[model samples]
Target: MDYAFAGAMSGLVAGIIVCPLDVVKVRLQNQPPISLTNYNGTFPTLVRIAKEEGLKGLFSGLSPTILSYLCDRMLWFATYESFKVAISNHTTRKLDDPFVHSGSALLSSVVCVVGITPLWVIRTRMMTQNTETIYYYRSVSHAFKSIIKKEGLTSLYRGLIPSFLGIAHPLIQFPLYERFKIVISNYEHHSKLEDYNPNKRPELSNLGILTSSIVSKFIAAVITYPHEVIRTRLQTQTAPLNKNFSNNTSVIPNIVPYNGIVKTVKNMVVEEGWKSLYKGLPTNLIRTIPSAGISLWTYEMILNNMKNI
Candidate 1:
């Protein structure tokens, strides 16, 4: 019934459904510009991962992925709902107003991004870890311990800036969703007046909600995709090898520092061209649309059911 609980449940379901796609996306995004290993595309990458590493590979980092999203979505919805209520109390506008919803979504996303950045860093590192590479993480705990011990606490927040930029995603998505809801509701009301069918109204609302979720997610993902690439690069950038671990012999090459978001974008464009900023975007869309739609549907369903109870 609680917003946080509803969000966490919805996120857990969405994360599980989208984990395989996410693993593929992360692998594709984390690839070096001029690497020996590169996936041809989403299907080929999926096949390769499955053939080489089996199902486990497809679900790599599922634990941390779900955990990160669970917490992230919980914080996001809880904060957004709380902010919406607080703002509505002060403002003349209705709580459901698109501007208020958008503002709440943006602020909530910023807060959640800060809180969940480390978990996301861990999830990305774990997902992108190639066993063939010298550095391999055994588990979520192993990844966290290794990263903290080797890279310091700040490493966990490596992509915080770009992630903050990611607030633009929900800012756009929730506003569009609210606007779409209003438009769809108005259209459905007109249709019902002509047809005078009460039974169909709920169905129309449900369809509108799902459609809005999918459309908003797609648009937001495309516009904000470049930030995703930057965030992945920042998070996956490895620390310089420790001299003490020199004898270990199985050290993966360190990732070149990405500097800051601006420098990183410039460097990527120089080395790999502007298209590089949208690497894995296709896969990202495929994953995000359904994931977001399902999440919104689930969240709304749960909230409604809880309200009835």
Candidate 2:
């Protein structure tokens, strides 16, 4: 419950603040690799979206984004702690064991990806579409219904495979964060566990945590970025538009949808070059790394205060 509250509340704050960047990132990602005029650069894309679609377009998926972060962070933090405890108990190792942390993060990632993938699919659809697009979702529920009705029930889980593979992001991130935080906490107070307190704020540890979170999230996002591009492409791919995919082709018609993570990677690389896998990496990193750091920092800050209260 403590972790849940911290994760959800902090995620809400972070999500709202960083949603505009996310909107641009998803747009960049959903576009074809060789676009001359669409979603060009981070700043350009932001201006383009705002100019063409207004603030509503800039914050296109805010509602679903908030819901996704709430469910994602809440489940992730809670499940991570539970998995860490269970894994630690099963092993003959302490809670701070790197192995335990990585394993716990991996398991928790699985839970989160499976639990809230549909929300993400809906969110992606909402983010990518605009008023001029073929199907702009009226609302979150409307998006859900349109997808399930027009595409089918299974379409709600469109990017499940790449999402599963994207677990590598947290598999590396959370463990590194845990290890870094412990190191910083110990170094700050001159003892391994003395500065570590649930019911009190650690002295002089906020900056260290911020640094650790930024570094960890940056590395993880870069390493696991291709899966993100693949996932977005998969989620944005809809069923055939009236028995002929070519005739009434959408804006990004040049992008051929491919299924299976490895096959998609192969096809993308073979057809569009290796850069295709990193289409929106700049915007993604700019948006998500800071957002992730903020969420982590906020989570720790809030959790400590909650415990103290």
Candidate 3:
């Protein structure tokens, strides 16, 4: 099986299905810092976006998000497979070695972050801004050009630091996922994982993979979610709006541009409390838990069928 092809399909499926939820999550994350708008919960936020902005609102960043996943997952799985193969060959370690999974995923994440941060910056802007704002971007390419023109080339990689920090997510997740696969295989008395095979054992079925993905993803997400909020804020955040605007009648939350990660996080905690750091957690969980499971399941299914063919 072509790991690249399998990963690409997995990303496309997951990105499209979870995009609406992603918009909600970003809006929630972006809003709290400035008191722009308050979102109550996941379902409520989804309902509000649909009611006010319609389907287009829900899918605002669809193009960039889709492209992001396609490129990200293609690089991710391809790199992982290459790293896994190389490490196992050199060290004579089993393919399932924990270091193999963790190292591969972390390296793959770095590759994705470097390659894809600009897409994410564009996506965040598209999601948070409408036609009214100076930052609103119509198409992905327009956003790309506009950001560079207006804010300079570095703007496209605004949240790059936190994005690199986000590697911790897949590092924790893929390794734990591999560990879980080993557990399931052992539980079923099967020596090899069903990662690319569905007929070996019923215990290592789709359900097992799904469960592993959900548990690993959920854990990783919970631990790493604050970085997500910080990253979004940095990406969509506008320049410091009217330094003396605090004395004015109305003040926008985008008043402060998040500068460094530590300063931004410290500011969020001081101003909005620690909860602000986890602004979109519930929505994120709802969107991502199943999304991860589905992504892995899709990749494995594609790989399995392709191998059989």
Candidate 4:
């Protein structure tokens, strides 16, 4: 219960702080291939959004983002803590072992992805909508209804495969965090390695948690980022209108809508080159590093306080 509460609070604060960067990242990722020159890059995209859409533009989809974070983080921490406890109790191995941590993170992520995917899809679509394009969603509830009515139930799960692939993120992140904790502990103890105690959770300093989270998240994000682009593209695709049906039949037939993971990857590479897979990496790193650091730090602090009380 305490873990779940702490996680929800951490996610809420982190989501709010990083929402503008998230908005920028999504816009960059979901931009049409031809419009790359218009947005140019991260700062230019931020300026464009602010100039054209006002300050509100930076916070688009904040409602859904907050809600998603609340539920997703709650479930993730609860399940992860539960898994760690179960693994420690059942196995002879230490709970802080790399494999144990990674396995727990992977399992927790699976459950989190399954439950929170639709909310994330809704958030992405809302964030990417702009005045230059036809608005697909007026609001979160409206988007949910419209997607169901127009695109069918399965549309909400469009990016599930790539999201599943994203499990590698926490697989890398948690293990690195454990390793960093070990290094910090050894350093503090004058070069003597200490075994982690499963019964007593060691309190990590704020700086240690922040530094570890930033390093781990950055590396995990860079390696796993292509899947993020694919997932956003999958979620934000809409059906085209027939306004240009009479203009050019050839163009109409050639318009490739985002399909599944493999088809989307093939089409993206063919149309925009392999570099397209990493379109919004800079903005994503900016958003994720601080957001992840603050979140982990906040989660640990809250959990520590709860344990003391």
lDDT of 3 by residue, 1-309 (tens): 399999999999999999999999998888754453567788998998898889999999999999888888888899988888787788877677788778788878888899989988888888876434444566899878766655579978888999999999999999898888768756666554445332232245788889889999999999999999999988886444443333222123466557799999988888889999989899999999989999999988888888779
Stretches of model 4 off by over 4 angstroms after superposition? 189-191, 239-255
Q: Rank the candidates by lDDT, best first.
A: 1, 4, 2, 3
- Per-residue lDDT of 44-85 in model 2, one digit per residue for the tens? 999988898899988988999999988899999988888887
Residue 115, model 1: lDDT of 90
Residue 253 alpha-carbon offset, candidate 4, angstroms: 12
For every candidate structure, what is the RMSD over all alpha carbons to the true structure, in angstroms?
A: 3.6, 3.2, 4.7, 3.9
Measured on C-alpha atoms, candidate 3 has an lDDT of 0.81
Model 4 lDDT-worst window of ten: 245-254
> Candidate 4, after superposition: displacement of residue 76 in Å?
0.7
TM-score of each: 0.92, 0.91, 0.89, 0.91
Q: What tens digits encode model 1's per-residue C-alpha lDDT throughout 175-249?
A: 887666666766777753334332221334678779978998888889888999999998888767776574222
lDDT over C-alpha atoms for residue 161 of model 1 = 94
Give the distance in Å from residue 34's predicted Cα in candidate 3 to where it truly belongs.
3.9
Better of 1 and 2 by TM-score: 1
